[model samples]
Target: MPSQATTAPRVALVTGTSSGIGAAVVEHFCKLGHQVLAVDFNPAGKAVAGKAGAVFYEADLSDPDACRGAVTEAVKRFGSVDILVNNAGIQHVASIETFPEEKWHQIIDLMLTAPFLLTQAAWPHMRKKGWGRIVNVASIHAQVASPGKAAYTSAKHGMIGLTKTAALEGGEQGITANAVCPAYVKTPLVDNQIADQAKLNNMDEQDVVEKIMLKQAAIKRLIEPEEVAQLIAYLASDAAGAVTGSSFNIDLGWTAH
Candidate 1:
């Protein structure tokens, strides 16, 4: 059981909460008794928020101003943010040579810049209260590499850098910043990727999963979003106060070899 004080109705801001890992994290925090602010541009977010009993904010995090607005809205609705989960992201598939400039900018802006801006806005409040948790939902791609995902990889890599810097600055103020980097999780995002990889590699969906996605994993299976949510819940807990500036991998041994 969670402590009442630790699991009390603290304000939490979770981005990209319409589906996948983001949605799972929001639901997990809500179950722990936190008042969550779920932000996502997806129309499904409203329904998810209702189910989770969390306040919802619909906004495109790719926009810097929208990122700031998310923080502002969370503050207004929930009083002060005790946890900020930077999870809004999208994937673009293309090699460096063929990657569209616009798509590159969009991915960077959304996956990397939005986290920076949101953290910036939330920092003062966290600093003032002398307690905070910032969890960046990065990818294993942040450390490893795959073909046709330069923009996605770069953005995730940048998130790790931001996590370290913020952790250094916020340590004295009782704020902790860390990232969770996972390999392919069984989400709608990865479901879409199955078809994309099939077309890209001229293979069937099963072949793509077997020959590509799980080929590097020692576990030979995709991770579940709930598993990632459990890790986020731990990081947000007071028990994890000493863990900061770390990239905890749930990568199924992808990086082992």
Candidate 2:
């Protein structure tokens, strides 16, 4: 990265900031002097974001109105929303044949549509300023597929399309949109997956980590949340001004194959 520029600190709205990649992002941006509005449905996120020096807004992204309202709060409280990070997500791991239709809707609503609505809400402010950044925290599943992650893979793939479309529309306005695709990370979500996969596959937790989780990656370890956060901070910075409409992977070589 280039020497940090002396740009004015931005007003940022970040979703999913209660834990995992979201929490890490809140910490990183606060450390960089940006005023962050951390939004999460989890009330626990309130204290987490507060500790990171960010204002907290508890809103469930799955509700379309909540997405818009979160952005509204950011602009209402702070002057403008210079950056939006859509990182809230959940997962279910049943085979498509047995996948719950409700689970599909829930995942899609939160991961794909909410980002679009939040972007819609934030677009005008960004247009007014002639500068903005939108980063979607997608997954390696955006590029590749696996058994029993139908809804997850679908939402991630849709995210790339949403990001590219936003980039095309925002290109001339100095607003860049992109997605960061990370593989399995050491997050509470992944911890749940470890336990779930063990039960689903009739394997021990260690066996699931080695055989199911790390089997496809050349680097056989879970990614740290901070690793993903670092990449996101760079993408949101002026340093990546020309990098948009693309998916940057920190997938432990999972997609290299």
Candidate 3:
């Protein structure tokens, strides 16, 4: 029913489809009648893609070659990649003084570099089509910083830069590049953060949620994955043709102050 009103079905290559924001994006695009190629390291992603009628490609984006291969596989199977959702991410929480070097490279590769690689691989196809949409799932961390998130903040910040750069390059073509930056959301990643923050802050998980997480947020709650998915769907739609080179914050006012 939701798929009935689309201009035509296009292919969307979405990373991190195992769960959370990535999973929600897959569902949204499918409802909008697009063919989705779901990429994730987790095997669970296969089932998620199957249920959503998306093709699944399991990949660890830390490897640069894999990022290129993912786009190629999508093109091979679907003909073109009209939309790219660079939503894959992992978090590492620790003071910069105590962060591991390997973890830094790993986080940076997956969050920041992989998006660029995937976008590069998908560029020619979009150029051929004369239209494309790229939605990078950045975070409030992309705009602001937190105490124990050195690696995460750095990678997310880079994502914003990548989004802007992509926008400038894609402008001449009909491709638009944008980012959806959300505040803390209820996902396994955030749940892990809740637990880690409690230990790091010497508080219970509930205190971390109430005091730390919501302290700067006006909404006083975690954002839902569907809420983010809706925005991604919009950016990937024709309605958002002029919305490129922008970072839209769904941060619940975390950055307002």
Candidate 4:
């Protein structure tokens, strides 16, 4: 295999940079001296990007055009996009019968289709440069199932398929694709889910965390955003040039059983 040819301070385009894992990834890459284009639909992402010394692009990633445009904007700003992190996602919990069709589309589009579009847009640049890293932030749900997460599970599972395909096609060109499947992380998203779960189950938030979210894990704690970010940083680095088409689980032993 060809050695990773991308030079130092490569440009990275990360989606969903407004908060949680996305914000942490932007901060990590920026701290590593890489030029980062932080894309998020949230206006507050501007502050995050600014504080991290990254350029911010506000766009709804669910929009197909916005996905492609983000790649263009990154290249226009930084000359080339050497790393792409598809991390934008939203969760809607509902039974299959009660899940809204529009909500399903929203989740699939943002979490699944957006990554494909962004990857398609970034492929040529990476092919030309002979090096690229594409990290798809999947979930433990990608490999497992939850009762009310029909759409989320489907999208994450599809993300792994996308990762494998990209890895196979990009392997010879020095572009590696991988997925990071993290269990519940300490983020606003999970916090909101905990509140909702507590109300639904008539239990305290702490109980929901201990009995519901971490039930399968031997280690009973939520993973931190920075912890996940460290793994993502490793997969995105040239040191992981040969690690492709695999899903690394940071599931706090959730899948051990």
Weakest 10 consecutive residues of candidate 2 by summed lDDT = 1-10
Please, what are the lDDT tens digits per residue for candidate 1 over residues 96-186? Answer: 7878999999999999999999999999999999999999999999898898888999999999999999999999999999999999999
Candidates arranged by lDDT, highest first: 4, 2, 3, 1
Query: Which is better, 1 or 2, measured by TM-score?
Result: 2
Q: What TM-score against the true fold does each predicted structure earn?
A: 0.96, 0.96, 0.96, 0.95
lDDT of all predictions, in order shown?
Answer: 0.90, 0.91, 0.91, 0.92
TM-score of 4: 0.95
Number of residue pairs clashing in candidate 4, backbone atoms closer than 3 angstroms, sequence gap of 3 or more or interchain:
0
Please give, for residues 124-180, the per-residue lDDT of candidate 3 as tens digits.
999888999999999998999999998899899999999999999999999999999
Residue 110's C-alpha lDDT in candidate 3?
A: 97
Q: What is the C-alpha RMSD of each candidate to the true structure, in Å?
A: 1.8, 1.4, 1.9, 3.0
Q: Is candidate 3 or candidate 4 better by TM-score?
A: 3
How accurate locally is residue 52 in candidate 1, as Cα lDDT from 0 to 100?
Answer: 90
Q: RMSD of model 1, in Å?
A: 1.8
Which regions of candidate 4 fall more than 4 Å away from where they truly are?
1-7, 199-204
Candidate 2 lDDT over residue span 37-133, tens digit each: 9999999998999899999999989998899899989999998999999999999988888899999999999999999999999999999999999
